[model samples]
Target: MLTNIFIIAITAEAMSGALAAGRRNMDLFGVALISFITALGGGTVRDMLLGNYPVTWTQHPLYIYLTIGAGLATILLARFIHRLNQIFLVLDSMGLIAFTIIGCNVALKLGYDTPVVIMSGMTTGIFGGILRDIMCNRTPQVLRHELYASVSLVVAVVYLTLMSLGVSHGVNTWGTFFFGLLLRLSAIRWKLSLPVFSYSPGRWGD
Candidate 1:
């Protein structure tokens, strides 16, 4: 079940990265590169932080192939895809939740504490998009607006709570996934965002 969800998450993220590359008028190589990074960057970072040697993609070469295939498919179906913005948004939200759950599980299995588990979830959910945005020279959505990382944090908390209460693994996983997805979709639908902080300079000698 986790494997299935992970595959979906990676594919969705890859497609999003491919679309970003396409929007920038990048070549196929650029599209593939961005897709690969966006799909695996978060997991890679998480593994590195945890010292889970070899990284995920290196351990599962098929993941790399899947991302590359997604990139190529996005390029081939660019026009049709562009017309389906809402669909992509839905997929992206699912991917975010899926990644968060996967990250939490990974940390839990590794005997990490709750705080680390929560941070791991957020890192897995958002860093891939961050890398993709940086590579594309666009402001990351997490930094600019939306309840992106917040949603992931919420998922981690819910998952942890459920586990502590002795909830079944299947229930915990799906419940967290659905709740997070709903929160993310609602945020998108209502343009929900965290309050922005702005810095202003005062008079030097005032």
Candidate 2:
């Protein structure tokens, strides 16, 4: 079940990445590259950190083909996608929550400590989008946006707490998914955000 959702999440992310590439006036190759990164970069980073050889996408070549195909599909659908920003936001949030849970599970199985598990979840949730943004020459949204990474953190924390309380895997997964999705939707609807820190440039002697 989670694997199926993961596939859906990656497809959505691939399309989102394609949109970003198009906005940058990138070629077809660039679109495909960005789509691949946005779909799998986070999991790649997580696997590398955990020393898990053969990252997820490589082990499952279907993921690679699917993501690239999604990007190309996005290029064909670009004319209609701009109006579907809200839909994509929901899909992206789903991906964030799903990836975080999956990453946390991987770390837990490896006997990692709590902090590592949390960080694993977050890294898996956000790094793909961060990489895509970097490649597109833009600031990463998770670093400066409304409750993006926070949503991942919330999901991880909730899942961990549930696990420690001896919650069954099925309950924990569904519960955390709904909780995280609601939090993300609320953030978007209400424009919820952490306070930004901006600094004014000053003369050295001032």
Candidate 3:
């Protein structure tokens, strides 16, 4: 079940990356490159930080093929895909939640504490998009808009709470997944965002 969700999450991330590449008028190679990074960057970072060698895609080459294939498919269906913006947003939201859950689980299995688990979840959920945005020279949506990383933190907390209450793995997983997704989608629909931080240079000087 987790494997299936991970696959879906990576596929959605790849497509989103490809769409961003297209919007930037990138070539096929660029599209594939961004897609790979967007799909694997977070997991790669998590594994490296946890000292889990060999990394995920290195162990499972099929994930690489899947992300590249999704990117190519997005290129072929770019026009049709452009018409499904809302659907893609929902998919992206699901992907974010799925990544958060997977990351939290990985950290928990490694005997990490609550704060570390939440940080791991947030890293896995947002780092990929951050890398993609940097590569594309745009402000990351996670950093600028909506409650993206906050949603990931919420997923981690909810999962941990559920587990403490003796909830079954399946229920805990799906419950966190849907709750995070709904919260993220609601934020998107309602233009909700965290308060922005700013520094007034003149005031600081004064």
* Prediction 2 global C-alpha lDDT: 0.93
Per-residue lDDT of model 3, residues 1-206, tens digit only: 66787798899899999988988999999999999999999999998898767787898999999999999899888878768889888888988888988889888888988888888888888899999999999999788898888888888899999999999999998888889889999999998989999889897996
lDDT of every predicted structure (CA atoms): 0.89, 0.93, 0.89
Candidate 1 residue spans exceeding 4 A from truth = 200-206
Q: What TM-score would every model get versus the actual structure? A: 0.93, 0.96, 0.92
Go through the candidates in order and give the C-alpha RMSD of each one to the true structure: 2.0, 1.4, 1.7
- Give the winner by lDDT: 2 or 3: 2
**Cα lDDT over the full model 1:** 0.89
Give the Cα error of residue 42 in candidate 3, in Å: 0.8
Q: Between the candidate structures 2 and 3, which one is better when assessed by TM-score? A: 2
- Quote the positional error of residue 198 for candidate 1 in Å: 2.9
Report how far off residue 12 is in candidate 3 (Å).
1.5
Inter-residue clash pairs, candidate 2: none
Against the correct fold, how does model 3 do in TM-score? 0.92
> What residue pairs are clashing in model 3?
none
